[model samples]
Target: MNAARTQTDRTTARSPRPRAVLAALAAAQFTVMLATSIVNVALPQIRDGVGLSDGATTWVVNAYGLAFGALLLAGGRVGDLLGRRRVLVAGLALFALASLAAGAATSPAALIAARALQGLGAAAIAPAALALVMESFPAGPARGRALGVWGAVSGAGGAGGVLLGGALTEAWGWPWIFHSVALATAGVLVAVVVCVPRPPGGRDEGPAGRFDLLGTTTVTLALTGLVWGLTTARGAGWTDPRVLGALGASVLLLLAFVVIERRRPDALIPPRLFRTGRVAAGNVLMALLGSVWIALFFFLPLYQQQVLGSGPLATGAGQLPFAAANMLGSSLAPLVARRIGARATVTGALLTEAAGLLWLSRMSADGSYLVDVLGPSVLVGLGLSVAFVQLTAFAVDGVPGKDTGLAGGLVNTTRQVGGAIGLAALTTLAGSVTAASAHEPLREALTAGYRSAFSASAAVLAAAALLALFLTRAGAPPAVPPAAPAPRPLTPEPSRAP
Candidate 1:
């Protein structure tokens, strides 16, 4: 009770310019999300230009995702201890510097290293920005609207990454993609400095607490090992010694993390968080949802380019329909949530996703874009967009303000981990099908593999829908308005820089 009061005390002075704060937060989100997919279209050029073998090339993407997912929980904890705005600025600085390094890299090793640094920065920025948004807008109509815009930017940034990457790579070169990201991030950084107001203690004051070192180390390594093993399993085979060892070690480390968290005074993820049915169920469904969305982006490009013989630029442009639908859905999510409630909205969206994936599975070796792809892509995009917004609000709802950052980190980490695992599983399934169909024509074999993967993804979504129906709780707590202000101790003005 005292802790809750202390948290309420901390956020008493609401930022007067909520719109500016929302815009800055959304732009910050877009900047990090763009990095997630900007390099995807440029992967081929990166591999060739950096003299990387096919095997090593995957790391260019995997390294960033792995590091980002692994460190997210720790990053959120850090933000909770430090101020969210301060952590956000620090994260932006790191991300921009890493982008510079990535743009300048001439070797594969340097590129991969720089990508990992970018992931670390992203791990910090994503959760802090989210927490800041939640704090800035008092929960009610204002908060719902802010979250709607926030979700739209998150979805659009990811979908737009493909289009932007293609244009930049085709016009200039692969390095230019990173350079562009660096510039955009710098712009957002400046907006953040000017637009985001400091909290009552002038941003320097934070909740006095000890960092949970033991819990942090254990959870970070456990997630890293798990993500590494799953990502490598597609190429290495599940039975390979290295893959088996990593999986086994991850399991042991996770147990250790659980044990450590139970005993630690300042747990990285408090054990009681799981007791909240909403948080637990939200995280689980988010994982399944993440897997499907990530795999869709991954496999759809393959189908477009390899099967349809489209160029990279055309393939990226093809996703514009999905992006459009996603933005439309995001804009409508708050209304839907208000009408039917968050849980039902999410359940309905998941079912819609299943239906869309099932439609997509109807594709043949020679499929028409309009009938076979576009219609289903639009459905999937809209459904996933609504799901993303509702699920995000549901996950952190009812949690104390102090722990909202951790909740955000937890949900995002699960999503990333789920994506990695799902992609690997589906990739292996497709590889096996392709090998088995080796007797058929190459195009037919590839189509069969992709079709099977899409079917599997649809099944996953249906299962997730069922889980949402049964496990997810209905309605969130009413948003607590900020407390009235009292005179705060004098401190130095917040630094615009770290």
Candidate 2:
């Protein structure tokens, strides 16, 4: 009896603290997301430093996203098989080395190669880190709080990238931007190793599933082609031969991938995942949210620079309001969800986002940033942050620990793919509008194009709102410690009040 009591007490004492683990995981997430946008502001300096041709300059940015999006599923499967912590640490090491290489690159090709490597490392880090969060926090308020921090970091990371990159490039140099990332990554790695605990099972122990080579190759290549084609189409026309060819290849390859996965005993991403209504719906909503978020960032900058005549510094500063609001929303998401339920929260958020986009669509060439842009920016920021927090939590809820990494990968892939495709479509539409209005003054023409794009984005958000009403209704009973009640079903019966 004494020995049993002592053992129980020791086990209780050894239980991990949630705060340290959440901080480390949030930091890891922030580091990888920061990589995505940090290069944008430094592109000109990078081009000049490396003597990159006009066309080659784009590759420096595109290479990372291509590799990240293509290999995310495979990375997640590796984590599920090998171990999440092991994969995360390995990814951080690889990311650090790649960042160092990128910082030291003397040529465009070298920089692009390093960036791609960084993407591959990020693919590993992102899913594993998310899985760690899922495993560490139980399915209740603790988990909700952790996810809110993660979502806040994700939103702020993107916004901060522009600010950090510009400051680094202007003050120190272009290479320092990468070097700074390398140092931050190194610090996060140390923190993760020290602070984040192993999953409920011991570290480095997971089902040693057989690797699926054919499935991996087909899906990775298919996604690569899709993202590349969409990204290129934004610059080159959709009718461009390369764009059309890549899209064609993506479709055929995706079909082949589906066939391979159906037959394979160990698929990279099991088709069964999509069969779950909650998982499927969460992914769909995330994709829509991602599309609108990316489009907002892409076009708002153009509006600031072209229509408002803001300098780069001022334009970057103009984004601060959105970032601040997003962080506030992330913090508030869990509290609001607990009060109202996830279904209502998501529906309300989508509607709010649609309203914001509609307001933004009313911008004119003569509009002032403070007077016209601030309100909509804050609304959209809050909406995006709240939606991200709820969707991310819901997507992985009730997923077995073994497949947590896979769930993470699927949500991320959907977001990336959706953003790429939606941005391409919206950009094309905006370009056409601009060309048609060429007879108008330049500022007016540009404003006209931006307005049309924002209007389309609003429609997309509204459509997503309708889908959310149906799809996000499923709810798991909250695990202990007194959090929210079971979320209302997305498609509740008429008798049950949503």
Candidate 3:
């Protein structure tokens, strides 16, 4: 499938250009998501470096999710309006510059702003990369394989991000995490401009459709307000007037955005897309799966730190199985999907994820990685492999070429938004329960928070299972036509009639 896309992506990509293009595009996805996970393993250092509280520090993470989530559809649309290759190049340059700025930053506010800009760049790059793959490959054996690689990079990027961050932060400090990424960004930016081929259409020279300004503003504010309220409400009470106002305003803003979308001719997301049962199911599942992933990474690291009493390096060690397992699963997904179909692969995946959640929930104070984490890690890895590929295929399935960007953005948007919502809700749940407990202040409270996040993650994965069941059609392979009946050997009567 990837080969087919490679063949179609451009005249330039027909031979050696394919390998270069794939590597650069994959590298682009890997690097951007790396920023999400890389800084995560260094949160303690980041907090101290910026002179911020743990609660304030969480915003550094959420800002990326919020901006990336809200602007994703628009970004995808922009790529379609302009060109995927062009937007990708521009985004890469912007991203590299942002990474340099982030690394040089000395204050929390500066880091937060830098991360937001990074998210904006990522928003442009992600959908463009995926759409380019989709536009290149036809739906069949080849597309599935390409999607498998695409899924793996996304799923494994999180694990690799944290691992890379841990190594860099320990050796070079938190700022170097951003610095290391900057170096890659600079290299990849050059590669993209040089190696990545332009789409068949040259560039979108169609009429400039009106940008959905009102929809953009409302959606961004709605998501940002909601994430802020939920993140902060943990430290301040939910009823704290500021938190309440923010949460309330966010809800109102979202409602307004929905109303605007329904009325707009050039809606970022058309109303009918939601009505497509498959697209709707796939979008919902992506969001839930995203929530599971982001929340797990957030709390699991805490488990090693506060619960298991590990430092950053030790936390990185603890993630070894998860990182390795995800990598292994990702590596094998394309081959497996080709042998067995994407439908069966994804169905099995969601179920396995639910089981992994149940196993992970068994974590205890005395738990070891072998007993408490390894099996679940492998299962979650497998699930990620299946879900990521299937969901990407699911979103763009049967969408018109003109709406390809919208299709890609819809799935990616679900993921980022789900993560934001998941983080807010999961974090709030943990904080609220911990605060109400009669235990000594911090550690026990945080433990309760971790459990809250885990349990919520499990629930979201469970919901994902249900959504996948409904969203996917039963037959992944189309039915073959019956063979024509064999002719009688040299029938003289039939020959005469003919």
Structural similarity to truth (TM-score) of each candidate: 0.92, 0.91, 0.86
Can you write out model 1's per-residue Cα lDDT over 392-481, one digit (the tens) per residue? 776676667777778879988988999999999999999999899999988789988988899999999999988888776545342221
lDDT of 2 by residue, 1-498 (tens): 999779656655665466777788898899888898887766778999999988888888788888888888888888888888889999999999999999999988899999999999999999999988777665667678778898899988888877787778878999988999999999999998877655444446556578888988899999999999998998888899999999999999999988888899888877666554377788889998888777777788779878998755676677788889889999988888888878888888888889999999999899889876889999998988888998887677666667788889888888878888888899889999999999999999999999999999999989998998878765543211246454321110111101
Candidate 1 residue-pair clash tally: 0
- Location of the lowest summed lDDT over 10 successive residues in candidate 2: 489-498
> For model 1, what is the error of residue 375's alpha carbon versus the real structure, in angstroms, after optimal superposition?
0.7
lDDT of each: 0.83, 0.83, 0.72
Q: Candidate 2: deviation at residue 168, Å? A: 1.9
Using lDDT as the yardstick, the better of models 2 and 3 is: 2
* Candidate 2 local Cα displacement, residue 332, angstroms: 1.5
Put down candidate 3 lDDT per residue, 155-259, tens digits, no spaces: 667877777888888888999988888899999888877665543344433235767778877887887787677667656767899999998999999899989
Q: Clashes in model 3: which pairs?
A: 1-142
How well does candidate 2 score on lDDT at residue 142?
69
Off by over 4 Å in 1: 1-16, 275-277, 474-498
Task: Write down the TM-score for model 1.
Answer: 0.92
Steric clash pairs (candidate 2):
473-489, 473-490
